[model samples]
Target: MPKMKSVFVCRSCGFESPKWNGRCPNCGEWNTFEEVDALPKSSSSAGKSSARVARSITPLKEVDLSEASEVRYHTGMEELDRVLGGGLVKGSLVLLGGEPGIGKSTLLLQICEHLGKEHTILYVSGEESARQIRLRAERLGVVGDGLYILAESDAQAIADTVSSNKPDIVIIDSIQTMGISEINSAPGSITQVRECTNLFMRLAKSEEIPFFIVGHVNKDGAIAGPKVMEHIVDAVLYFEGDRNLSYRILRAAKNRFGSTNEIGVFDMKDNGLEQVENPSQMLLSGRPTGVSGCCVLCTMEGTRPILAEVQALVTKSGQTSPRRVTTGFDFNRVWMILAVLEKRLGFCYSALDVYVNIIGGLKIQEPAADLPVAMALYSSLTDKPLGDDVIAFGELGLGGEIRSVSHVEQRIAEARRLGFKKCIVPRHAIKSTQKFAGIEVIGVSSLRQAFEAVK
Candidate 1:
């Protein structure tokens, strides 16, 4: 028998200390430290011995490639497929995270309708009863004959079932509720989430079956568990949108098999989640026409180009320090843009309350959005409205120069498809870009030139 060893772990970040502390040094969360076992000596040594026996090293060139081709499983959603780098790869572990009622489980259940045609799916739920899942599935019209439901929380039991049955696909309602009897920590605790995810990861790889695990986000909008849990998964997709709104955006934060920049848009309907194929059109819908402080910009979300409306309001400030507010845009970048506007372009915004917003819930972190935001501010400040058909995208420099952005051709094509008559781009990018027929492309080197061309 091995002596018991204990440690204090931060529930928020899984930071372990030999003793307890009021505040977690790593995550800065107070009163999060809880006593937990360091590890069972018997289990630790047993795991090490098993790992040594299981080790099989092969030359990189000798690795088999035959099973790697055309093994993707289409989820019956084009937007989701696009975000997933074509389709879900076999034997991959994908973690989908979002706020409560943000449609994480709904997305998985809806996909089963398509995947269940040829593949058997084991849908495991620890948080909800089988009847509750059935009720939701019925509402979503997911009446697949091959979809099996298991309402269990024991991780080892689920692994045993998967190993014996070898289902084509597995869906865990959430990792938070799943736990192993071996571990004394309660379910949803950092240790349980981390260990449970690891169990599923190994099971998915060894069994060659794909997995979709749900994760609940904390108030900080990050997945509730140790950060290691996210690292163990093959892909981490976050569903972003206001619950009060009908739209949701699934963006991949990490993807080992695909690009992380991809995003999937879905519209929440009475039935279930419906994929939005043309996210540009969906975002640009209900856009105001010929409005001052409003302009359209084309941004590339992974390989897809999306056109979003940027609006800014410049008003006289009542307070000593004028407010510089932004929604869906970076605060520090706004300050830099304002500084450039005042210093280089001779536009005084120091005493004005500047408010900038992106029309859709979609956030614009790309520097390509800088030009449009600046243009919107100028339009509101000068009380002049640019042409409704005009679209702008370019990075701004402190020296008052417009910097060229990547995916120039794709952005222009999306704008042209959206029926924009005029396009504004960096002057340097025009040298290599071909002129389009229907739209007038204006290349401006400076903010003044951009404003003059639009005027």
Candidate 2:
């Protein structure tokens, strides 16, 4: 028998250290070191594994690529399928994370209803009892003979059940509660999460089973557990939306099989998550007919063009320093736009409390939103209303020039489909050879021209 030694690990980066420190030397994160027991290595098992392993490696060209045609399992949710790069690939490990009460469990359970009809699913819940799962399943109207529920938290026991049952797909309600008995640390610790995920990864790869692991988010909105946990998975999907709002957006933070730019939008309802097929129409619904400080912008999400409303409020400041508040839009970008407006267009903003918001809780990350933001700010400051029939999308430079944006034709087409009569784009965006119908495209060379055209 050997005595176990205590070691500290950084919760952020999974860096192991023999002693504790204020900051991790590997990742430079402070107050993240958690002390855990380090078990002695089993040399007998290690030797056995090494002895059974093959020393020869096959050449890359000699490997057969026929296995790439393995069929994917569709969740029956088009939005989810889009974010997952068409559908869930076989033998892939996906980590779905979100804040509490953000519908992480609801989404998974809902998918089982569709997947259970065609494939066997092993849904292991560590957080809730079997009865609780059944109640929720009944509430969601999910019924299937192929959906197997096991309310267990022991990792080794779950693995044994998986090996015996051999389901086509598996869903771990969450990874935090499951723990291996061999490890002395409590469940959800860094060691438990890492080891448990490693076990599931091996199970998925070796057995050709697709695994969906539900993960909880930390205070920083990152997937809970060490950062290495995210690196171990094939894909990472984050569910994001305000609790007060009925809509939830599913985004892929990392994907090995598909594009990370794609997003899935769902309207959370009492029944379940209802997919928004035409997100543009849903976002633009209930928009004020004619309003100042509001402007619609065409932004691209992956290959899909989306229309978002940029709203700004400019008012005289009553305090010593005028406030700058923004939601769903970059704060620094708002400041830069104000500075550019003041420096180039001679708009006095030093004493104005400027507030900017993106309607529908959609965060505009692209630089192409600059022109709409500027136009919205100008409209608000001047108390001039830009009619709802106009759409704007272009990038603005410090020199006040509108920079050309990509997919201008696509944006214009989307605007037209949404019944917008006019579009304000960059001068260079519209080439002499290009043409569009059903909407008037006004090309602007600078911010001044854009403001004049909008008014």
Q: Which candidate leads in TM-score?
A: 1
Per-prediction TM-score: 0.92, 0.90
Report the Cα lDDT for candidate 1. Answer: 0.87
Of candidate 2, the 10-residue stretch with the lowest lDDT total is 39-48
Model 1 lDDT per residue over 295-356, tens place: 99999888889999999999999999999999999989999999999998889998999999
Off by over 4 Å in 1: 1-62, 67-70, 220-223, 226-228
Model 1 poorest ten-residue lDDT run: 219-228
Could you tell me how far off, in angstroms, the CA of residue 130 lies in candidate 2 after the best superposition? 1.5
